[model samples]
Target: EAGVTQFPSHSVIEKGQTVTLRCDPISGHDNLYWYRRVMGKEIKFLLHFVKESKQDESGMPNNRFLAERTGGTYSTLKVQPAELEDSGVYFCASSIRTSGRAGSYEQYFGPGTRLTVT
Candidate 1:
């Protein structure tokens, strides 16, 4: 019954360092998504997980990023050799799958984790 939760609400790291972010979605929810908003950019979808499988990941930026959902319960995103441009607010959301009804389901979002790369 819990909403999504993110760990280490804020992170600060220098460029070329590695950072990992975590998200725990609501119970019984099969849809989990990751998003981010960099400076001067709109919030963009990074990837989506339906249970343990990746449903969509076309939005993932580059090879430096990796996302995984283990056991379809919690998810993690890691950025290696982080760049200054990676500084942003990372958001995680989850929602229950509805029967193909438009506007019938709403995604619940977690308090975003702010990352700063210097």
Candidate 2:
């Protein structure tokens, strides 16, 4: 089976431009997550989607970032008016639905998209 995959391995945009990152998770997986490592900082969780519903989005940086999982197959993360601070390696991960422990399941990750905002 194929693992998660992200499009546009790299993107460079102006500060006020918009960039959308897409992720295709492994088939049959119901849990999807978005994460990023910015300014050389450790990777941080951005949001999570269970099927087509958002389970948690508390880690999203701000209103400028929007994430969506359409039809529960693929997910997209868009950053409007991108800022220099948003430049980072954006990662997408997926796994089977967790039952009890939150961190018990093994998540598969994509190669990640490197975004550069100038």
Candidate 3:
């Protein structure tokens, strides 16, 4: 059963360390979204990628964080100088389409990659 897969089920890093998280979406899915929950905060959207292009990146928290979907395939998220506040579960989701759903589509999420910063 192929859905979405995230690497490094859990990671612990010291402050200022760089960490990279990866995501593999379902085959043929054209839309992908990244979201996360940090420090007991509500799940926040990070960005959306349609194929190899970033369709919406308004949710990116800061410049220290970078996201990319190369070759319109798997994606990678890198946080440079990871801060203590960067510890949280990062989720990846994908679908044929997200917005303007005719009620027949739903976003499928991965188990998530938990990052611990200290």
Measured by lDDT, the strongest candidate is: 2
lDDT of 1: 0.93
RMSD of 3: 2.1
Runs of candidate 2 exceeding 4 Å displacement: 98-104
lDDT scores for all predictions?
0.93, 0.93, 0.90
What value does the lDDT take at residue 19 in candidate 2?
Answer: 99
- Using TM-score as the measure, the top candidate is 2
**What C-alpha lDDT, on a 0 to 100 scale, does residue 14 get in candidate 1?**
95
Q: Which regions of candidate 3 fall more than 4 Å away from where they truly are?
A: 97-105
Q: How high is the lDDT of residue 16 in model 3? A: 94
Write candidate 2's Cα lDDT for 63-118 as tens digits.
99999999999999999989889999999999887677675267899999999999
Error at 71, model 1, angstroms: 0.3
- By descending TM-score, how would the candidates be arranged? 2, 1, 3
Per-model TM-score, in order, reads: 0.93, 0.94, 0.91
* Pairs of residues at least 3 apart in sequence or in different chains that clash in candidate 3: none
Better of 1 and 3 by TM-score: 1
Per-residue lDDT tens digits for candidate 3, residues 1-104, read: 69999998899999999999999999888888899998788989999999999999999889999999999989999999899888999999988854576521
